[model samples]
Structure formats: structure tokens, C-alpha cells
Target: MSIAQLTVVGGGLVGAAIAYGAARSGISVRVLDQGDAAFRASRGNFGLVWVSSKGNKMPRYARWSREAVTIWPELHKELLELTGVDTGLHQPGGFWLGFSEQDVEARADLLKRINCEVGGEIPFKMMEPSELKQFLPGLGSAVVGGSFCALDGHANPLMLLRALHAGLKEKGAETISGVDVTEIRRDPDTTQFQIIGRDGQRWKSDRLVLAAGLGNANLAPQVGLEVPITTTRGQILITERLKPFLDFPTNKVRQTREGSVQIGSTSEDVGFNDGTTTDKIEWLARRAVATFPALANARLVRAWGALRPLTADGYPVYQGSTSCPGAFVATCHSGVTLAAIHAFVLAPWMAGLTCAPPDIECFLGDRFRDPNASFSHDH
Candidate 1:
């Protein structure tokens, strides 16, 4: 089996960013995309490059997210220059609104704990309604308080995905779309991986990366990796383009560059059913209106659901197969927020250009190997 220098079996944000980064590093790359039918969380993304309440239990992940957002602009700029595509990144900070004092207090505690555990790098402010209103004048009366994180922000997720794919093409990487990868086999003697499609199409490469989102659960085992990946359907709502009212992105609602307000996301453990429900849509709309009274008059134009590729503890899985050298698996729900780190840091290591990040051990997939260990997926 012979193909490019690196074969990435997933063409969404995670795969594309890594592929683009490897290509920019002068390695020939090929991306096998599962196409439109796949559970593409990239397309249904809420577009928040957020880091406020992440890693509540693990400090390493919090710091990882902090580092990712800091370097996001570099990826954005490089992609723009290389592919002439704008990702619409905004880092003016973001908010997490709450309608009850209980929830607000818990949020404050979580943020404070995360900040302390991460060595005070994840700065946040617990704000009263008045202070929040200063930044968000459209704040509704139902909102009692919120937290603000300077490192939090948002971007056009679709644009970011587009820019990465465009940059992949510009960097001379091959992207094979509309194909389902059915199997992956690693030849121990040759140290090569053969990727087989559903239709028997096959390609091979010296290095293989399985960043296939939820699909990683099955594919990882093929290459001697154990990734415990679970899917949670997140239903989101989008309103028609409105006047620029939202100056900053919030957990519940955010106005896009195109003026449509993105109201999201209910984390339902419904097992791979990526379909929106009227009840969830109404809940989102009501909450958005409660967050900003101005949204009461907004007309909802679209609603959809996407499955988030989460680990047992909702952190991430970046593991290289010791049993099968040159094979790796990368999976995380924070694709948009972590795109920069994936491109600039993880890609180089996966392509054998540099050593793995020092903290890579913290995100290994085997952490969940204990069958008796109980886990949570709050991310």
C-alpha cells in the first residue's frame, strides 16, 4: 500500500486543521472525508472559542484551552494569508448568563476553582446584572448575574472549517470527500497503514491519524488504540439576520458576523439521533429571549442538531499507539476552540516533526480503562 506521507481519516475541523498544519510543514498529506452524511459537528457548531467553565475537574485541560485560544489568532492569520479566507475571529471576551442566583453562584465557584487550579491563568469575573449590562445593554431582567472570561470569544465556525480546507488545498494536501472509511489495518513489517473505504477503495501511508470524531471509537481499536468516545446530541437554533445587538458571545445566544443570532444547544444523551425537537427549540428560544429581551421579536429561521464527540470525562483523547507505531487518535468536542492547538502543536508531533507536548500524558485515552471507575461528561 502506497499513498501520501500522512493519511488523516476524517476531514472535519480536527482532521483538516492537523492535515493543513502537516502540509504547511512540507509533508504530503491526504484527508479522507466521510462527506455530508457523517455526523459533522463542525457544521452545526455554535462557534464559541470559549474557555470559561472548561476543565472544572482537570486543570491541564483548562490550561490547554487557555493556550489554544491565545494562539488561535496565529492560525487564523496564517490561514488567511495562505488561503485568502477570513475566519471572523473575535476575542473581545464572552459571558455566561444565568437566570437564577443558585446557578450563578455555582458558576462563579466553578470558574474560581478552575482559575486557581490552572495557576490563575484562566481569569474570570463574577459580575452582577448591572456590570453585565454595561457590557451587554440588552440584558433581560430575568438574568441575575454572570461570569466573564477575557480569553473567551467566538468565530464563524463554518468559515473556520472552510478556511482550513481551503488552506489544505493551497498547501498541496489531498482531500478525498464523500467516502466512508470502513477499515484500517497497520502492517507491522512495513510500519504502514492501509485505509479502506466502504466501496473497497484503499490508500496507504507511513503515518495515520484517526480524528474521525465519534467514528474514532471504532477506528481507534483497529490501530491498537482504545478510545472511549460517546455521542451527545446538541440541538441549536438560529434566528434570521437582525441588527447588530449582541456585542459579545454568550453561552445561550450569540450574534454571528452575518447578524443571525445563534441560540444553542441542549446536551441530550439520545444516542446518535441528530434531529431537532420542537420542545428543545422552544426551550432554546425562550431562554434566548429571557437572556436578551430584544430577541422576543426575532424570527427563528433554522434549527438543527449535531452530536458532540466526547470522551468519558469530556476532556480529550490524544494518544499515539505504542503497539502500532506511527498511528494516532485525536478526539474532542471542543473542535473550534482547540483548532489552533491541533494545527500548531499536535499536528507537528503526529507528523514526526517534533516531540509530543509535555502534558500529552494527561489526555491519553487509556485513562478510562478502569471498568469500575465512574465517569461524567459535563463538557
Candidate 2:
């Protein structure tokens, strides 16, 4: 196999961010994308750069998310300068509405624990309905209370994806689209990886990164790693363009730059069925209306479902293959929130220009190997 410098399989947010980062580091890079037919979670995301309730069980993830949001401004600036695209990042802060006192208390506790675990880096407040109303004038009566986090915000996800691909091209990185990677094999003598496409085309690289989202499940094994990934469908509803009302993003809803109220997302365990259901859609609509009564008059314009690439424990899996050197796997559900770290930190480490991020050892795939290890995707 004739080795190229680097090959990244997958071209969605996760893959594009890493590829863009590597290309910016002056490495020869190529991205193999499975095309539009692939289940792209990036397209259906709520576009939140959130940090409030990220890592309740694991403080490392909370810190990682905090760092990602911290560096997001730099990433946003670089992408705009390189590609002439604006990612629509707004970081005034965000709110998580609670329907009842119990919900409010639980949210406060979760935020308190996360902030404490992360050394009080995440500043938050438990706001009463009256206090929240000052920030959110249109808040409905059903919104009993909520938690406010200064680090949370949102961006235009589609534009972010476009800027990443454009940045990759500007850096002279090659992108092969509409190609289904069927196999990954390494030559014993040269130790170079040959990635085989479904059409029999082949590409070789000295370093290979498996950032194929859910597809990592099959591809990781060939590279001597394991990624226990599952898919959960998230349904989203978009209303007709209205007067800008939301100044910040929420866990369930946000008003976009174009004035459309985006309401979403039920975490359903239906396997690979990335299709919206009437029941879920109605539930989301009611929930949104309950959160903001002004939404009752908004007309729904679009609805969609996207699969989230989730690990068993709802944390990221960043592992470099011990058996297959130069092979790495990166998977996470918070692709949008963590895009900054993926591009700035993980990319440099993968290119061998920098050491791994601090505490990255906790995310290794080896954690799943323990027979007694319990897992939960509640996050």
C-alpha cells in the first residue's frame, strides 16, 4: 500500500471538524463520505453549543464540553476567515425550562453537581418563573422555573457543516463523496491501511481515523477497536418564520436566525428508524406551546427525524487502537457542542503534533471491556 499522510472516513460534523483541524495543521488529508443517503445526525441537530447538563455522571465530559464551548469563538472566527461563511453563533446564555417544582429542583441539583465537579467553572442560576420571565418575556405560565447557564448557546449547524467542508477544500484536502467503505485492511510489511470502497476503489494512508458516527460500529472492529454505538431517533419540528422571540436556545426549542422556532427531539430507542411519527410530533408541539404560549399561533412548516450516534454510557469514545497503530476512533452524540475541541484539540493530537488532551484516557474504548461495567445512555 502506498501510504498517504491521513485518511478520515465520514464527512459529517464529527469527521469534517477533525479533517479541517488536521488540514489546518498542514497534513495531507482525505475524507471519505458515504453521501446523503447515510443517516446524518448533523443535519437534524438542535444546534446547541450547550454545557449545562452535559456530564452528570462523568466530570471529565463536563470539563471537556466546557473547554469546547470556550474555544468555540476561535473556531467560529477561523472558519469565517478561511471560508467566508458565518456559523450564526450566539452565546448570550440559555435556559432550560422546568414544568414543575420537582423538575426545577432536580435541574438545580444537576447543575450544582456539574459545576462543583468541574471546579465551579460552569456558572449557573436557578431562576424562578418571575426571574425567567425577565429574560424570556414570552414564557408561558406552564414554565414554573428553569436553570440558566452562561456557557450555553447555539449556532447554525448547516452553515457550520458547510464552513468545515469549505475550509477543508481551502486547505487542499481531498474529499471523496458517495463512497461506501466496505473494508479496512493494513499491510503487514508497510503497516499502511488500505480502505476499500464498495465499488472496489482503494485508498491508502499512514494514519486512519474512524469518525463515521454510527458506521463506526462495523469499521472499528476491522481496525482492531470496538465502538459500542447505538442509534436513537430524534424528531424535530420547525415553525413558519415569525418575529424573533427567543434570544437563547433551550433544550427542547429555539428560534433560529431566520425566525423559525425549532422544537425538537424525543430520544426514542426505535432502531435506525429515522422517520418522524405523528405522536411524537404532536407531543413536541404541545410541549413547545406549553413552554411558550406564543408558539400556539405559529404554523409548523417542517418536521424531521435524525439518528443520534450514542455510546453505551452516553459519553464519547476516543480511542487509539493498541493493536493497530495509527488507527483511531472518535464518536460522540454532542457533535455540535464539541466541534471546537474536535477541530482544535483532537485533530492536533491525531496528527501527532500535540499530546492527547488532559483526562482523555477516561474516554478510551477499553472501559467497555470490563465484564462488570454498567452502562447508561441517560445523558
lDDT of 2 by residue, 1-379 (tens): 2235889999999999999999998989999999897899877888999998889999999999999999999999999999999998998899999898998898898889889988999999999989999989888999889988898999988899999999999999999999899899999899999999999999999999999999999999998897999988888999999998888888879999989999977889999889989999999999999999989999999999999899999999998888888999999998899999999999888866787889899899888889998999774
Question: Best lDDT goes to which candidate?
Answer: 2
Clashing pairs in 1: none
Which 10-residue window of candidate 1 scores lowest in summed lDDT?
A: 1-10
lDDT of the candidates, in the order given? 0.90, 0.91
Query: After superposing candidate 2, which stretches have Cα over 4 Å from the reference?
Result: 1-4
Which tens-of-lDDT digit does each residue in 81-154 have in candidate 1?
98889999999999999999999999988888888888899999999999999999889999999999999899
Residue pairs with colliding backbones in model 2 are none
Give the TM-scores of the predictions, in the order they appear: 0.98, 0.98
